[model samples]
Target: MSLESFGEQLRRAREAKQMSLGEVADATRISLKFLQAIEAGKFSILPQAYIRAFIREYARAVDLDPEKTIQQYDMANQEIRATAEEWVSRSRNAALRQTKERTREIASLPVFSQRSVTIFAVLVVAAVAVVYLLNVGSDSSQQDDVSEIAFDKVIRESEAATVRTESGRALPTFEARDDSLRLEITTIDSVWLAITIDNTRRGEYLFAPQRKRTWVGKEQFQISIGNAGAASFKLNGVELGMLGNRGVVARNVLITRSGVQKTQQ
Candidate 1:
């Protein structure tokens, strides 16, 4: 059977068992929308990790044989997987072969004299030392006048949830700051501002529309949320939190044992 057909069959079996989409979602902790997508045969909408997990959950929830359903799915998609694997293997082999050829070409180059190599090494070390000293001197000089370490990076804190930027557009990604944090805000309409610190909901206030709000911090935990704007942040690859329209804002913040000083605007 075709992969699409297999997905359809799975959906039929699930419905025949009188299972609601939300029930499966609740049991699996997968989103209701994602569960509906699976039932609709829109398997491509799911990430690979969730696809298999969804299938397992669906089967188990309907009392169908999970192994059989998975086997059928594998059979249906075997050709696609095999073709993809073949392409990946060929690409890897080609890259490795090219690397070996480049290595051979470099090895065949004329060798420098021993004295020339020694001078090059000395110059390289001097250049590195100069770079290190310049960076250190610049940092030290800035410390006296700098109020805070200020930098802007995208904040991506959730895998399944989307973050809205100040532009009223969804951000595909976000960045985290190690030295300090930045929170930028703007409103399409006069609305309330509610933010959370370290996943704890903070205060709320009325913010006028078309105005920009900005916050600067050296704190470990940071988040800002409002009804009229978008908010998101990241610490490395992990998402810190996501803010959406309506409801009290809940955000995650990382704190050291000594605790972190926080600010909101």
Candidate 2:
């Protein structure tokens, strides 16, 4: 007698064990429809991606060797795989032949002649030269503008370095000394100001009317005021005079232990 197919073997085993499809379905918790399809060998009717799991479940329910049954199923489909391979081989050979014919036809078509190629190369070179000359001219113009801007910046910075005083009355200058310097600023009115001592920020305060702030520094003290006329200064307890013009912002005042000096504009 001929050996049974995978589905026939499953059916025979189930019958020998006297287990109905419904009974196996309930036991395995698989759908009765899918179980029937598995036994019928209509694996496509079930989910082809999970056909192996279905078969395994069915085989186990019937007490058949799941691995052996799967091996037999694979053997049964070997002929189908061979047939598919044969078709794929034929299709690939046909496609390769068509691609070669298309390539040969393209190669046979005329491309640019030597004279056309020479003319095209000359045009490309001319275009590149024109672009280079334009870029060079633009760079030169930019450099000139940059030079003018740099000159203006230098002039502005020189002005900023000088202290602006009323009527050009010569402002005092002090020599750098290592001794301690003390500054006393008494606000005539409320003045917003920032003070720095020895290159470190001391404080920025909005002094109340008539309020006085004093600081002693080892190296130097720098003060900036929002309302110059609102404050008066004393260096080492010697009154220096009016700090600045009313409503005018004084950004720089150089102070040293020797004396108080004016910063350049």
Candidate 3:
């Protein structure tokens, strides 16, 4: 029955639970910034659906009713959007006024003759041909790199062995055949992983059993496994075996031209 803002209500609820923002973040896996935004009524900082999700998580963390909190958040959002629409209408009116003042003579320019249009089209075609030739030359350079390496054979482990971080453990090796390394993975069980191919963060995603994920890397791959025994991996078509046991966590396993190796933590 309280007529307070959604943020105020949530904030009061959180305070009643006697918890800090960081504690809520740790419990819900929601970032502190998002938590702050939620408590500040900065719903515009996040997508509407995500704001609702944050509200639900925050409510759960504070032992508040998620449905009630989400309802309050939705009402508050509708009000905010309504005000935004009013502002947009006023801005549009001002823009129209300004537009009417600018009666520039853009149509005064001479139109292209039929012969001039033909010449312009020809130039555009020539430019496109130049771009195509440049791309083909770059592709040829990459092809030359593959030809330098021998794919007639692949280097692999003598047996399915666990890759280790210790200095004495042998690392697997594969010949670099192109501008990038091709990595193929198949989930053996329900697994979660974080993948970075050539330093690009592909993000953490869940994979069901038998799901295949293929990635390419120009230099190396950085992979973290939530369940090591849940996935089978291949480097350029060479089977590398399962990573580890069930429920095992592998952080930043490195894959490069030299081979697959667990990074030294």
Better of 1 and 3 by lDDT: 3
85-193, model 2: which lDDT tens digit per residue? 5655565556556555655555565896676566556655655565566555445433312243443453345334433233545444444354557688887765555
Evaluation by TM-score, superior candidate among 1 and 3: 3
Candidate 3's TM-score: 0.38
Off by over 4 Å in 1: 79-265
lDDT of 2 at 72: 77
Q: What shift in Å separates residue 219 of candidate 1 from its native position after superposition?
A: 25
Model 2 backbone overlap count: 8
Give the C-alpha miss distance for residue 202 in model 2, angstroms: 3.1
Per-residue lDDT tens digits for candidate 1, residues 1-265, read 6667887887788789787776765454344555677666665543333366457666877888977887887786665455555655565556556555655555565986676566556655655565566555445433322122220110111212343433547534223456555555555543333343333323233343354554334443343333313433333323433344432222332332233233222
Error of 3 at 159 (Å): 34
State how far residue 62 of model 2 sits from its true place (Å): 90
After the best TM-score superposition of candidate 1, give how far the Cα of residue 151 lies from its true spot, in angstroms: 26
Q: Report the C-alpha displacement of residue 210, candidate 2, in angstroms.
A: 1.1
lDDT score at residue 50, model 2, on the 0-100 scale: 39
Worst ten in a row by lDDT for model 1: 148-157
Clash pairs for candidate 3: none
